[model samples]
Target: MWTLVLNCGSSSVKFALLDVQGGQVRLSGLAERLGSAGASARVEVDGARRVVDLAGGSYAEAFAVIAGALDELGVRAQVGAVGHRVVHGGERFSAPALITPEVLAEIRACVPLAPLHNPANIAGIEAAQAAFPDAAHVAVFDTAFHQSMPEVAFRYAVPGDWYRQHGVRRYGFHGTSHAFVAVRAADLLGRPLSELNLVTAHLGNGCSVCAVQGGRSVDTSMGLTPLEGLVMGTRSGDVDPGLHDYIARQAGLSLSEITAALNRESGLLGLSGLSNDMRELEEAAGRGHAGARLALDVFVHRLAKQMAGMAAAMGRVDGLVFTGGIGENSAWVRGAVLARLAVLGARVDEAANAAAVRGQSGVISAPGALAALVVNTNEELMIAQQTQTLLAEQKGVQA
Candidate 1:
């Protein structure tokens, strides 16, 4: 069976074709800068790659391009299912859902909670439905895995009405990544996921750390929104609530503008006054860019602080699994974070750390130290497998 995993952003579409039976990704690509003059798709089909210009295409057009690419690769008709990445499921969905009118409506109800992400998710789901009408379309939520978080770990120390009426509580993001890495970490450590207490950090442009105890997310750094986690490529994570009010009164800025700045104009970009790319920051930091160095320091320290907190949520640390772009590629970042995590007994082997980059997974910790492993995240594959599981359940029900 083949599955198509689709992740739709406001202006981009990321897709992967997985051979579910073969247990491998057959194709993957990204269509970015949609609704723009320079819109294009960078596609990888069976180890071969190419770029196709969309020439100012809409979201629907982007989906069309993706579907057309799959068709050219002769895998379109073989697509058994389509798994869509829906960012915020809120409290309504705790597992991957077979998308129906009712499930679609439930997802819509979550739009208010994720104004920036859910709308685009809906757009992708709707477009993928139209493109692959014959295939099963399932929604794999980013918030679903963290739904296991206990109340004490998720609840904010705020008013009850705000949480009861407005749903103002922690709903961590990057759940699929966290859940995927937890199991992978267990495999690397030669332990069962259900027997391990792990802290999995998904450190990309947007970063989050999760406390996985016995294969369930007990707690995570991100709360309610992705903006509440570690310092990201462009997001200011964990600011004092008073700053919002103070900045509003002093700078004469509206609450929305302040939020927009925090979400877009902050983090490494704001601190370095340069780029949000971690590779760029590392290079600039090496060349004596004080701002870049500060950004890296803050990012590393904040990550270590959160990792330590996540470890505190569990009984014992089996391993600290690093995934995502920065986690997988940056050896310096791994070393820096591990250095500060001495309290957690984290000690990295420099050779293993350097050798773990470029999508290779390895044990990076020193001999007999707390296990620090780099596990490459395969979210699309995770979505595909979840979609397949739901399909099997549906078949059993029908029979």
Candidate 2:
């Protein structure tokens, strides 16, 4: 069986075709810069890469081109199911769900919570449904895993009416990535995930840390939105709530303008005034660039701080798992973070840390210390697995 996975964003759609039986990515592609003149898709089929120009910026246009490409490449006909990555499922869904009309409406209701993501998700789902009309469609939510969070961890210290009338509480993101890496971390330690307590740090362009207590998300850094997490490529993590009103009064900026900057122009980019890419910043810092050095320092410090808090939430740190782009490739980052985690008994083994870069996975912690692991994340595969389980549980041929 094959699962076609779609992770749609405001300006792009990432699609993948995976074989569940063999656990292979038969096709992977990204259609980016949608709603722009430079719209295009870069696809890799069976390990060969190619690029194709798209007709327009609309989701329909991009997916249409992709569908045609899939047909030409002879990969479309084998899709047994379709899995859509819905960013925010709110309190409605705790697992992958078959997309029914009522379920679609529930996803629509979450648009307000994820104005920039859920609508694009809906768009991709609709377009994929049109493209693979005969296949079973499942919605895998990014917030579903975090639903296990207790009220004390997820609720905010605000007015009761705020949460009662509107959905204004901590709804952590990056559920798929966290869930994927936690299982991998358990595998590395040769332990059952349900018997281990780990802190999973997903360090990518968008970053978040999860407190996995017994394979369940007990708490997470990203709250309500991706912007609330660790210092990301362009998103500030843990800013003072009063800063919004303070910036408005002092900087003469509107609420939306301030938010836009925080979501787009902040984080390592804002701190360094250079690039958000960690590799570039590291190079600049090595050249004694003060801003770049400061950015890296703040990133390491803030990330470790969040990791410590998450470890505290779990009450024990069996393993500190790192995944995503930076987590998988940056040995400097992994070592720096572990140095700060000494209080939790995390001591980095230099050779193991250095050897774990560039997609390599290993135990980087010193002997008799809190285990530090580097695990590669595969959200698309996890989505496919969830979609497969949901489809298997259905009666007759779900497609």
Candidate 3:
């Protein structure tokens, strides 16, 4: 049976059709620029790529285009389940849920926690349900994996009422990627996930680190939202709470304006005063750009710092796993970050690090050093697997 996984953003939808038993991607594509003049859908199947115009379209139109493409490709009858990636489940959902009216209402209640993401996610879930009413629909939450965090790790040093009344605490994001990479790391090490302790770094446009012990998340970098962890492509990771008041008083900037700058104009872009892309920053630094060099330095330094903290959470680190764009492709970044972690016995083979790039997976640790690995993450595949499992459980219960 094939499971359809959908990741809906504010203006785009990424999808994959996976053979659940074999764990193979049968069809994958993206719909971009939805609800705009440039809207289009691109689908890849059977080693061929096709693009369909969806100009001035909505999610419904985008789904139609995908369905039409599947029909043309003769795989329309293969879909058995639909998986929707919901960004935040708040404190409620701890696992992938079969979508019912009650579950849908619970998801709707989480809109306030993820104002910019959950609404789009809900829309995608509703649209997919309509498009495949016969198929079982499951909601896979990004926050689900981190629900294993203990109270001490997730709580803030704030008034008890803030957490008790508002649900304000460290509800880590990137739980899917973190959980996927942790299991992949265990596989690469030829060990069971429940027997290993790992620190996972997911470095991309957005960055987060996770500490996993006995196959469960103990601590993660992101908190309450995606903007609270390691420095990212645009979002400032961690700033003193007082800085907001300072900026407001000294620069005459409104709270909203400051919030926008921190979310959009900060991070690598703000530090380098150039591009947010790590590739560009690295190139500029090589050419003697002071700001770029500083940005890279700060990024590496902060990442290493957070990684060490993750190790502390696990008490002992059996391995270190790197994923996402920067973590997988940038040999320099892997080396730089690991250089700081030598104190923890984390040392990478320079040659092996160079060889592990662009979706390549391997152990880059020097002989006898703590195992360090580069594992490519597949959040979509993970979601599909979870969806398939949930559907089977539902069927068994009914039977």
Please give the RMSD to the true structure for each candidate, in Å: 1.1, 1.5, 1.2
Model 1 is weakest, by summed lDDT over 10 consecutive residues, at 56-65
TM-score per candidate, chains pooled: 0.98, 0.97, 0.97
lDDT (0-100) at residue 17 of candidate 1?
88
Each model's backbone clash number: 1, 1, 0
Candidate whose TM-score is highest: 1
The clash tally of candidate 1 reads 1
Candidate 1 lDDT over residue span 1-399, tens digit each: 689899999889999888877877778889999878999888987898999888756877777777877888888888989999999999989999999999999999999899999999998888888888999999999999999999999899999999999999999999999999998888888888889999999999999999999999999999889999899999999999999999999999999999999999999899899989999999999999999999999999899999999898886887999999999999999999999998889899999999999989989999989999999998988888889998999999999
Candidate 1 lDDT score at position 251: 100
Q: Report lDDT (CA) for all predictions.
A: 0.92, 0.91, 0.92
Model 3 alpha-carbon miss at residue 177, Å: 1.0
The residue pairs that clash in candidate 1, if any, are 171-224
lDDT for each residue of candidate 3 in 1-399, tens digit (9 for 90 to 100): 778899998889999888877888878899999878889988898679989888666999889877876787687777878899999999999999999999999999989888879999999988988888888889999999999999999999999999999999999989889999998899899999999999999999999999999889999999988889899999999999899999999999999899889888999999999989999999999999999999999999999999999999888999999999999999999999999999999888999999999779999999999999999999999999999888888889999
Q: What lDDT would candidate 1 get against the real structure? A: 0.92
Stretches of candidate 2 above 4 Å error? 396-399
